[model samples]
Target: MDNSQKRILMAKTGLDGHWRGPTIVARALRDAGFEVIMIGMASTDDIVSAAVDEDVDLVGLNVGGHIDVAIRAIEQVQVARPGLPIFAGGTIPPHAAKQLEALGVEVYPPGSQLVDIVDAAERLTGTR
Candidate 1:
């Protein structure tokens, strides 16, 4: 892991106009020395392609709108790059969070600390 460059693919799985959460997380990931590939308002195809094409170590999604959208993207990413670690954040509802968690995505709802998210990126990508 010391010789590897940890890259993270960050995507928003909806048309939601909010950029604060993902932007902040992206910047924080960058500050932590991760190469963050951001595909804003991305579809499932876009997310999956980037997850593979970008050669990313981890994938982070902003589940802002329909929970199904995030689930679809996560599923595609899993198939495209099986066992790649994924995480998600947003004002997600309890049931939606449960669904994501069931998919093995570390769900971070509103008020989740930046340190925690960045730490997750490190752990997930084995950059710690």
Candidate 2:
């Protein structure tokens, strides 16, 4: 698939207003030619709704709160849109990353390189 044809839905699962991490990732994905739809500070319901409504090929989540918050959103998204590839980054500890990985989400904790993130997006969307 062409990069422009791949849509990625990005959302923050908590109330945290820190935008630097997600903003950078979104820009990188967009620069890499993917259409990125960023829904900032969304609830679990909002995330699931956007993933379906936007018809995104992949979901990228920025989890800044407790791991359970992100986990809840991930579970809901999976139930609502099974097989929709989901990846996450932001303030995640080792244990949280492991939990997300177990749920099939590609985890990129803080300090993850932009190139790696873009690469993951390409692979997840099959645009590589």
Top lDDT: which candidate number? 2
**What lDDT does the true structure give each of the candidates?**
0.89, 0.94
Each prediction's TM-score against the native?
A: 0.95, 0.98
Lowest lDDT block of 10, candidate 1: 1-10
Clashes of each: 0, 0
Candidate 1 clashing pairs?
none
By TM-score, the best candidate is 2
The C-alpha stretches of model 2 lying farther than 4 A from their native spots are none
Q: Write model 1 residue lDDT over 11-53, tens digit each, in one string.
A: 8888988899999999888887788888898889999889888
